[model samples]
Target: MKLSLKVNGKKIEKEVDDNTLLVSFIRENLNLTGTHVGCDTSQCGSCVVHVNGKSVKSCAMFAVDANGSEVTTIEGLEKDGKLHPVQESFKKHHGLQCGYCTPGMVMSSIDLLKSHKNPTEEEIRKGLEGNICRCTGYQNIVASVKGAIGKV
Candidate 1:
Protein backbone atom coordinates (compact mmCIF):
# COMPACT_ATOMS: atom_id res chain seq x y z
CA MET A 1 0.00 0.00 0.00
CA LYS A 2 1.12 3.52 -0.64
CA LEU A 3 0.81 5.56 2.53
CA SER A 4 0.84 9.31 2.40
CA LEU A 5 0.51 11.57 5.40
CA LYS A 6 1.97 14.52 7.20
CA VAL A 7 3.90 13.36 10.23
CA ASN A 8 5.43 15.74 12.73
CA GLY A 9 4.79 18.50 10.20
CA LYS A 10 6.73 16.69 7.49
CA LYS A 11 5.35 15.08 4.36
CA ILE A 12 5.70 11.29 4.27
CA GLU A 13 5.04 8.96 1.38
CA LYS A 14 6.05 5.35 1.73
CA GLU A 15 5.21 1.87 0.57
CA VAL A 16 4.01 -0.26 3.44
CA ASP A 17 2.09 -3.46 3.93
CA ASP A 18 -1.63 -3.05 4.19
CA ASN A 19 -1.53 -4.65 7.63
CA THR A 20 1.09 -2.27 8.94
CA LEU A 21 -0.04 -0.76 12.22
CA LEU A 22 0.21 2.97 12.57
CA VAL A 23 2.60 2.59 15.50
CA SER A 24 4.86 0.31 13.47
CA PHE A 25 4.85 2.72 10.58
CA ILE A 26 5.67 5.64 12.84
CA ARG A 27 8.46 3.88 14.68
CA GLU A 28 9.94 1.71 11.97
CA ASN A 29 9.21 3.50 8.72
CA LEU A 30 9.39 7.07 9.97
CA ASN A 31 11.94 6.37 12.74
CA LEU A 32 9.81 8.21 15.26
CA THR A 33 10.25 5.81 18.15
CA GLY A 34 8.65 8.11 20.70
CA THR A 35 5.28 6.48 20.17
CA HIS A 36 5.84 3.26 22.07
CA VAL A 37 3.98 0.01 21.57
CA GLY A 38 3.49 -1.36 25.05
CA CYS A 39 0.70 -3.74 24.10
CA ASP A 40 -0.49 -4.83 20.68
CA THR A 41 -3.95 -5.49 22.12
CA SER A 42 -4.65 -1.77 22.36
CA GLN A 43 -5.33 -2.03 26.09
CA CYS A 44 -2.33 0.17 26.77
CA GLY A 45 -2.42 3.76 25.62
CA SER A 46 1.33 3.82 25.12
CA CYS A 47 0.78 3.99 21.39
CA VAL A 48 -1.46 7.02 21.47
CA VAL A 49 -0.90 9.76 18.89
CA HIS A 50 -2.92 12.63 17.59
CA VAL A 51 -4.56 11.97 14.22
CA ASN A 52 -5.96 15.10 12.70
CA GLY A 53 -5.83 16.78 16.14
CA LYS A 54 -7.46 13.96 18.15
CA SER A 55 -5.73 11.32 20.20
CA VAL A 56 -5.90 7.77 18.83
CA LYS A 57 -4.09 4.57 19.66
CA SER A 58 -1.66 3.99 16.83
CA CYS A 59 -1.50 0.29 17.58
CA ALA A 60 -5.20 -0.07 16.97
CA MET A 61 -5.28 1.63 13.57
CA PHE A 62 -3.67 0.73 10.27
CA ALA A 63 -1.16 3.04 8.62
CA VAL A 64 -3.22 2.95 5.44
CA ASP A 65 -6.17 4.27 7.37
CA ALA A 66 -4.08 7.27 8.37
CA ASN A 67 -3.32 8.16 4.78
CA GLY A 68 -3.83 11.82 3.97
CA SER A 69 -4.22 12.64 7.65
CA GLU A 70 -1.94 14.71 9.81
CA VAL A 71 -0.36 12.49 12.46
CA THR A 72 1.39 13.93 15.48
CA THR A 73 3.48 11.62 17.59
CA ILE A 74 5.12 12.43 20.91
CA GLU A 75 8.04 13.71 18.89
CA GLY A 76 5.79 16.27 17.31
CA LEU A 77 4.83 18.00 20.54
CA GLU A 78 7.98 20.07 20.70
CA LYS A 79 8.58 23.21 18.70
CA ASP A 80 11.69 25.41 18.27
CA GLY A 81 13.66 22.87 20.31
CA LYS A 82 11.53 23.67 23.38
CA LEU A 83 9.20 21.26 25.10
CA HIS A 84 5.45 21.64 24.97
CA PRO A 85 3.75 23.19 27.99
CA VAL A 86 2.33 19.82 29.03
CA GLN A 87 5.75 18.23 28.76
CA GLU A 88 7.23 21.04 30.82
CA SER A 89 4.47 20.65 33.41
CA PHE A 90 5.18 16.94 33.61
CA LYS A 91 8.78 17.68 34.41
CA LYS A 92 7.92 20.39 36.93
CA HIS A 93 5.43 18.14 38.75
CA HIS A 94 7.45 14.93 38.47
CA GLY A 95 4.65 13.23 36.64
CA LEU A 96 6.81 10.40 35.29
CA GLN A 97 8.94 7.71 36.86
CA CYS A 98 9.72 4.81 34.54
CA GLY A 99 9.17 7.19 31.58
CA TYR A 100 7.52 4.37 29.63
CA CYS A 101 4.04 5.87 29.85
CA THR A 102 4.97 9.54 29.80
CA PRO A 103 4.39 9.96 26.07
CA GLY A 104 0.91 8.48 26.12
CA MET A 105 0.01 10.21 29.38
CA VAL A 106 1.13 13.55 27.98
CA MET A 107 -0.74 13.02 24.71
CA SER A 108 -3.94 11.93 26.47
CA SER A 109 -3.66 14.78 28.95
CA ILE A 110 -3.39 17.22 26.07
CA ASP A 111 -6.64 15.93 24.57
CA LEU A 112 -8.28 15.95 27.97
CA LEU A 113 -7.35 19.55 28.57
CA LYS A 114 -8.54 20.44 25.10
CA SER A 115 -12.03 19.20 25.95
CA HIS A 116 -12.12 20.31 29.58
CA LYS A 117 -10.39 23.64 29.96
CA ASN A 118 -10.29 23.50 33.77
CA PRO A 119 -10.86 19.97 34.87
CA THR A 120 -11.22 19.04 38.49
CA GLU A 121 -9.10 16.42 40.18
CA GLU A 122 -11.72 13.74 39.59
CA GLU A 123 -12.16 14.84 36.02
CA ILE A 124 -8.45 14.64 35.46
CA ARG A 125 -8.39 11.15 36.93
CA LYS A 126 -11.28 10.11 34.72
CA GLY A 127 -9.67 11.60 31.67
CA LEU A 128 -6.59 9.48 32.21
CA GLU A 129 -8.51 6.27 32.72
CA GLY A 130 -7.21 4.46 29.63
CA ASN A 131 -3.57 5.55 29.82
CA ILE A 132 -1.94 3.44 32.51
CA CYS A 133 1.03 4.51 34.58
CA ARG A 134 2.50 1.78 36.77
CA CYS A 135 4.61 4.29 38.67
CA THR A 136 4.02 7.62 40.48
CA GLY A 137 0.71 6.56 42.10
CA TYR A 138 -1.01 9.09 39.80
CA GLN A 139 -0.80 11.91 42.37
CA ASN A 140 1.92 13.75 40.52
CA ILE A 141 0.41 12.85 37.18
CA VAL A 142 -2.84 14.48 38.22
CA ALA A 143 -0.88 17.44 39.51
CA SER A 144 0.89 17.70 36.20
CA VAL A 145 -2.39 17.79 34.35
CA LYS A 146 -3.70 20.39 36.78
CA GLY A 147 -0.53 22.37 36.31
CA ALA A 148 -1.20 22.37 32.56
CA ILE A 149 -4.88 23.25 32.87
CA GLY A 150 -4.72 26.73 31.44
CA LYS A 151 -1.29 26.51 29.89
CA VAL A 152 -2.35 23.86 27.36
Candidate 2:
Protein backbone atom coordinates (compact mmCIF):
# COMPACT_ATOMS: atom_id res chain seq x y z
CA MET A 1 0.00 0.00 0.00
CA LYS A 2 1.06 3.56 -0.61
CA LEU A 3 0.94 5.95 2.33
CA SER A 4 1.12 9.73 2.25
CA LEU A 5 1.04 11.90 5.31
CA LYS A 6 2.45 15.06 6.80
CA VAL A 7 5.10 14.06 9.32
CA ASN A 8 6.75 16.72 11.44
CA GLY A 9 5.41 19.31 9.00
CA LYS A 10 6.98 17.50 6.06
CA LYS A 11 4.93 15.75 3.41
CA ILE A 12 5.97 12.12 3.12
CA GLU A 13 4.93 9.50 0.61
CA LYS A 14 6.11 5.95 0.90
CA GLU A 15 5.22 2.38 0.04
CA VAL A 16 4.37 0.21 2.99
CA ASP A 17 2.78 -3.11 3.79
CA ASP A 18 -0.92 -2.97 4.55
CA ASN A 19 -0.24 -4.56 7.91
CA THR A 20 2.68 -2.30 8.77
CA LEU A 21 2.14 -0.64 12.12
CA LEU A 22 2.47 3.13 12.35
CA VAL A 23 5.22 2.69 14.93
CA SER A 24 7.22 0.60 12.45
CA PHE A 25 6.69 3.16 9.71
CA ILE A 26 7.79 6.02 11.94
CA ARG A 27 10.83 4.21 13.29
CA GLU A 28 11.91 2.18 10.28
CA ASN A 29 10.93 4.29 7.30
CA LEU A 30 10.85 7.79 8.75
CA ASN A 31 13.77 7.06 11.09
CA LEU A 32 12.15 8.97 13.95
CA THR A 33 13.14 6.77 16.88
CA GLY A 34 11.99 9.17 19.57
CA THR A 35 8.67 7.39 19.55
CA HIS A 36 9.88 4.29 21.41
CA VAL A 37 8.39 0.83 21.31
CA GLY A 38 8.55 -0.23 24.91
CA CYS A 39 5.82 -2.86 24.58
CA ASP A 40 4.35 -4.04 21.31
CA THR A 41 1.05 -4.21 23.12
CA SER A 42 -1.17 -1.13 23.44
CA GLN A 43 -0.82 -1.23 27.22
CA CYS A 44 2.31 0.85 26.95
CA GLY A 45 1.87 4.44 25.81
CA SER A 46 5.48 4.66 24.68
CA CYS A 47 4.35 4.61 21.07
CA VAL A 48 1.92 7.49 21.38
CA VAL A 49 1.89 10.11 18.63
CA HIS A 50 -0.46 12.79 17.47
CA VAL A 51 -2.53 11.92 14.43
CA ASN A 52 -4.42 14.95 13.14
CA GLY A 53 -4.04 16.73 16.49
CA LYS A 54 -5.06 13.81 18.69
CA SER A 55 -2.87 11.32 20.47
CA VAL A 56 -3.02 7.68 19.41
CA LYS A 57 -0.92 4.60 20.10
CA SER A 58 1.08 4.06 16.93
CA CYS A 59 1.47 0.37 17.67
CA ALA A 60 -2.30 -0.09 17.68
CA MET A 61 -2.87 1.49 14.28
CA PHE A 62 -1.78 0.37 10.84
CA ALA A 63 0.45 2.63 8.82
CA VAL A 64 -2.03 2.53 5.93
CA ASP A 65 -4.70 3.89 8.24
CA ALA A 66 -2.59 6.97 8.79
CA ASN A 67 -2.46 7.78 5.11
CA GLY A 68 -3.32 11.43 4.40
CA SER A 69 -3.29 12.22 8.09
CA GLU A 70 -1.06 14.74 9.80
CA VAL A 71 1.28 13.03 12.23
CA THR A 72 3.44 14.59 14.92
CA THR A 73 6.13 12.65 16.71
CA ILE A 74 8.44 13.83 19.47
CA GLU A 75 10.81 15.26 16.93
CA GLY A 76 8.00 17.48 15.67
CA LEU A 77 7.65 19.18 19.04
CA GLU A 78 10.93 20.98 18.77
CA LYS A 79 10.96 24.13 16.64
CA ASP A 80 14.14 25.65 15.25
CA GLY A 81 16.58 25.74 18.16
CA LYS A 82 13.95 25.84 20.92
CA LEU A 83 12.20 23.02 22.70
CA HIS A 84 8.44 22.85 23.23
CA PRO A 85 7.19 24.19 26.56
CA VAL A 86 6.33 20.67 27.71
CA GLN A 87 9.82 19.48 26.86
CA GLU A 88 11.30 22.40 28.70
CA SER A 89 9.04 21.77 31.70
CA PHE A 90 10.03 18.13 31.79
CA LYS A 91 13.63 19.19 32.03
CA LYS A 92 12.97 21.94 34.56
CA HIS A 93 10.90 19.69 36.82
CA HIS A 94 12.87 16.48 36.29
CA GLY A 95 9.83 14.68 34.95
CA LEU A 96 11.74 11.60 33.78
CA GLN A 97 14.21 9.21 35.36
CA CYS A 98 14.80 6.24 33.04
CA GLY A 99 13.53 8.40 30.12
CA TYR A 100 12.06 5.42 28.31
CA CYS A 101 8.57 6.90 28.53
CA THR A 102 9.46 10.59 28.26
CA PRO A 103 8.68 10.98 24.60
CA GLY A 104 5.19 9.58 24.92
CA MET A 105 4.69 11.45 28.14
CA VAL A 106 5.61 14.71 26.45
CA MET A 107 3.35 13.95 23.48
CA SER A 108 0.47 13.05 25.72
CA SER A 109 1.06 16.09 27.88
CA ILE A 110 0.83 18.40 24.89
CA ASP A 111 -2.47 16.86 23.88
CA LEU A 112 -3.72 17.05 27.42
CA LEU A 113 -2.94 20.75 27.66
CA LYS A 114 -4.61 21.37 24.35
CA SER A 115 -7.87 19.96 25.66
CA HIS A 116 -7.58 21.30 29.18
CA LYS A 117 -6.26 24.82 29.15
CA ASN A 118 -6.16 25.03 32.94
CA PRO A 119 -6.29 21.55 34.31
CA THR A 120 -6.17 20.91 37.99
CA GLU A 121 -3.79 18.48 39.57
CA GLU A 122 -6.50 15.83 39.60
CA GLU A 123 -7.43 16.54 36.00
CA ILE A 124 -3.80 16.35 35.00
CA ARG A 125 -3.51 12.98 36.73
CA LYS A 126 -6.66 11.72 35.07
CA GLY A 127 -5.58 13.09 31.70
CA LEU A 128 -2.30 11.16 31.80
CA GLU A 129 -3.79 7.92 33.08
CA GLY A 130 -3.10 6.33 29.71
CA ASN A 131 0.65 6.99 29.96
CA ILE A 132 2.82 5.28 32.57
CA CYS A 133 6.24 6.25 33.85
CA ARG A 134 7.87 3.64 36.05
CA CYS A 135 10.69 5.95 37.00
CA THR A 136 10.32 9.36 38.71
CA GLY A 137 7.35 7.99 40.69
CA TYR A 138 5.04 10.32 38.72
CA GLN A 139 5.46 13.09 41.26
CA ASN A 140 7.77 15.10 39.06
CA ILE A 141 5.87 14.15 35.93
CA VAL A 142 2.67 15.56 37.36
CA ALA A 143 4.52 18.64 38.48
CA SER A 144 5.97 19.04 35.03
CA VAL A 145 2.52 19.00 33.51
CA LYS A 146 1.26 21.48 36.05
CA GLY A 147 4.27 23.67 35.59
CA ALA A 148 3.81 23.65 31.85
CA ILE A 149 0.10 24.37 31.92
CA GLY A 150 0.54 28.11 31.55
CA LYS A 151 3.41 27.88 29.12
CA VAL A 152 1.84 25.28 26.88
Candidate 3:
Protein backbone atom coordinates (compact mmCIF):
# COMPACT_ATOMS: atom_id res chain seq x y z
CA MET A 1 0.00 0.00 0.00
CA LYS A 2 1.17 3.55 -0.71
CA LEU A 3 0.72 5.65 2.39
CA SER A 4 0.97 9.41 2.17
CA LEU A 5 0.26 11.82 4.97
CA LYS A 6 1.52 14.89 6.74
CA VAL A 7 3.31 13.90 9.92
CA ASN A 8 4.60 16.46 12.38
CA GLY A 9 4.12 19.11 9.73
CA LYS A 10 6.21 17.20 7.19
CA LYS A 11 4.76 15.54 4.10
CA ILE A 12 5.45 11.82 4.04
CA GLU A 13 4.95 9.16 1.43
CA LYS A 14 5.91 5.55 1.93
CA GLU A 15 5.12 2.01 0.94
CA VAL A 16 3.66 -0.05 3.80
CA ASP A 17 1.66 -3.18 4.29
CA ASP A 18 -2.08 -2.71 3.93
CA ASN A 19 -2.63 -4.10 7.42
CA THR A 20 0.06 -2.01 9.10
CA LEU A 21 -1.16 -0.43 12.28
CA LEU A 22 -0.86 3.34 12.48
CA VAL A 23 1.33 3.07 15.53
CA SER A 24 3.63 0.65 13.77
CA PHE A 25 3.84 2.89 10.75
CA ILE A 26 4.62 5.90 12.86
CA ARG A 27 7.27 4.20 14.94
CA GLU A 28 8.73 1.84 12.38
CA ASN A 29 8.28 3.55 9.02
CA LEU A 30 8.46 7.14 10.21
CA ASN A 31 10.88 6.51 13.11
CA LEU A 32 8.65 8.51 15.44
CA THR A 33 9.01 6.29 18.46
CA GLY A 34 7.33 8.71 20.80
CA THR A 35 3.97 7.08 20.13
CA HIS A 36 4.44 4.01 22.29
CA VAL A 37 2.60 0.75 21.82
CA GLY A 38 1.93 -0.42 25.33
CA CYS A 39 -0.80 -2.83 24.40
CA ASP A 40 -1.77 -4.08 20.98
CA THR A 41 -5.32 -4.66 22.23
CA SER A 42 -5.99 -0.87 22.26
CA GLN A 43 -6.86 -0.99 25.97
CA CYS A 44 -3.91 1.27 26.69
CA GLY A 45 -3.94 4.81 25.43
CA SER A 46 -0.15 4.80 25.08
CA CYS A 47 -0.54 4.72 21.32
CA VAL A 48 -2.72 7.80 21.11
CA VAL A 49 -2.02 10.40 18.44
CA HIS A 50 -3.88 13.24 16.82
CA VAL A 51 -5.31 12.44 13.42
CA ASN A 52 -6.58 15.51 11.61
CA GLY A 53 -6.63 17.37 14.97
CA LYS A 54 -8.49 14.70 16.98
CA SER A 55 -6.95 12.20 19.35
CA VAL A 56 -7.16 8.60 18.18
CA LYS A 57 -5.60 5.37 19.40
CA SER A 58 -3.13 4.58 16.67
CA CYS A 59 -3.09 0.88 17.41
CA ALA A 60 -6.78 0.65 16.64
CA MET A 61 -6.47 2.20 13.19
CA PHE A 62 -4.65 1.15 10.04
CA ALA A 63 -1.99 3.30 8.44
CA VAL A 64 -3.83 3.09 5.13
CA ASP A 65 -6.86 4.58 6.83
CA ALA A 66 -4.72 7.58 7.80
CA ASN A 67 -3.63 8.27 4.27
CA GLY A 68 -3.98 11.94 3.31
CA SER A 69 -4.64 12.89 6.94
CA GLU A 70 -2.44 14.98 9.15
CA VAL A 71 -0.97 12.94 11.98
CA THR A 72 0.65 14.40 15.05
CA THR A 73 2.59 12.16 17.36
CA ILE A 74 4.06 13.13 20.70
CA GLU A 75 7.08 14.33 18.79
CA GLY A 76 4.93 16.91 17.02
CA LEU A 77 3.87 18.63 20.22
CA GLU A 78 7.22 20.33 20.45
CA LYS A 79 7.86 23.33 18.26
CA ASP A 80 10.87 25.60 17.98
CA GLY A 81 12.63 23.24 20.36
CA LYS A 82 10.12 24.04 23.09
CA LEU A 83 7.57 21.68 24.54
CA HIS A 84 3.86 22.28 24.11
CA PRO A 85 2.13 24.13 26.92
CA VAL A 86 0.38 20.95 28.08
CA GLN A 87 3.73 19.19 28.10
CA GLU A 88 5.32 22.05 29.99
CA SER A 89 2.46 22.01 32.48
CA PHE A 90 2.86 18.27 32.88
CA LYS A 91 6.52 18.69 33.56
CA LYS A 92 6.01 21.59 35.92
CA HIS A 93 3.30 19.74 37.83
CA HIS A 94 5.15 16.40 37.87
CA GLY A 95 2.33 14.70 36.02
CA LEU A 96 4.49 11.76 34.93
CA GLN A 97 6.52 9.09 36.66
CA CYS A 98 7.35 6.07 34.51
CA GLY A 99 6.84 8.20 31.40
CA TYR A 100 5.32 5.33 29.47
CA CYS A 101 1.93 7.04 29.48
CA THR A 102 3.02 10.68 29.26
CA PRO A 103 2.72 10.91 25.49
CA GLY A 104 -0.83 9.61 25.42
CA MET A 105 -1.78 11.59 28.47
CA VAL A 106 -0.44 14.77 26.92
CA MET A 107 -2.19 14.14 23.59
CA SER A 108 -5.49 13.31 25.26
CA SER A 109 -5.19 16.27 27.59
CA ILE A 110 -4.74 18.56 24.62
CA ASP A 111 -7.97 17.27 23.10
CA LEU A 112 -9.70 17.56 26.46
CA LEU A 113 -8.65 21.17 26.82
CA LYS A 114 -9.82 21.91 23.31
CA SER A 115 -13.35 20.80 24.22
CA HIS A 116 -13.36 22.17 27.78
CA LYS A 117 -11.68 25.54 27.97
CA ASN A 118 -11.79 25.59 31.73
CA PRO A 119 -12.43 22.11 32.95
CA THR A 120 -13.06 21.32 36.56
CA GLU A 121 -11.26 18.53 38.33
CA GLU A 122 -14.17 16.21 37.70
CA GLU A 123 -14.34 17.16 34.06
CA ILE A 124 -10.65 16.63 33.62
CA ARG A 125 -10.97 13.27 35.26
CA LYS A 126 -13.80 12.34 32.97
CA GLY A 127 -11.97 13.59 29.93
CA LEU A 128 -8.92 11.49 30.74
CA GLU A 129 -10.91 8.37 31.58
CA GLY A 130 -9.73 6.78 28.36
CA ASN A 131 -6.07 7.24 29.33
CA ILE A 132 -4.70 5.25 32.24
CA CYS A 133 -1.71 6.44 34.26
CA ARG A 134 -0.47 3.87 36.70
CA CYS A 135 1.98 6.07 38.54
CA THR A 136 0.46 9.48 39.30
CA GLY A 137 -2.93 8.51 40.77
CA TYR A 138 -4.17 11.45 38.65
CA GLN A 139 -3.75 14.09 41.35
CA ASN A 140 -0.93 15.82 39.52
CA ILE A 141 -2.36 15.01 36.14
CA VAL A 142 -5.49 16.92 37.03
CA ALA A 143 -3.33 19.72 38.35
CA SER A 144 -1.35 19.75 35.13
CA VAL A 145 -4.58 19.99 33.13
CA LYS A 146 -5.77 22.76 35.41
CA GLY A 147 -2.45 24.50 35.00
CA ALA A 148 -2.85 24.40 31.24
CA ILE A 149 -6.48 25.53 31.20
CA GLY A 150 -5.99 28.72 29.22
CA LYS A 151 -2.62 28.02 27.66
CA VAL A 152 -3.81 25.55 25.07
TM-score of each: 0.98, 0.98, 0.98
Q: TM-score of model 3 relative to the true fold?
A: 0.98
Model 1 is weakest, by summed lDDT over 10 consecutive residues, at: 35-44
lDDT score of residue 4 within candidate 3: 88
Cα deviation of 61, candidate 1, in Å? 0.3
Query: Model 1 segments beyond 4 Å from truth?
Result: none
Worst 10-residue stretch by lDDT in candidate 3? 37-46
lDDT of each candidate versus the true structure: 0.93, 0.94, 0.93
C-alpha positional error of residue 18 in candidate 1 after TM-score superposition, expressed in Å: 0.3
**lDDT of candidate 3 over 22-76, digit per residue (tens):** 9999999888999998877888798999999999999999999999999999999
Each candidate: how many clashes?
Answer: 0, 0, 0
Off by over 4 Å in 2: none
- Model 1, 20-132: lDDT tens digits are 99999999988899889897788879899999999999999999999999999999999999999999999999999999999999999999999999999999999898898
**RMSD, one per candidate, in order:** 0.7, 0.7, 0.7
**In angstroms, how far off is 32's CA in candidate 2?**
0.4
By lDDT, highest first, what's the ranking? 2, 3, 1
lDDT of 2 by residue, 1-152 (tens): 98899999999999999989999999999999999998788886999999999999999999999999999999999888899999999999999999999999999999999999999999999988888888788999999999998787
lDDT comparing candidate 1 with the true structure: 0.93
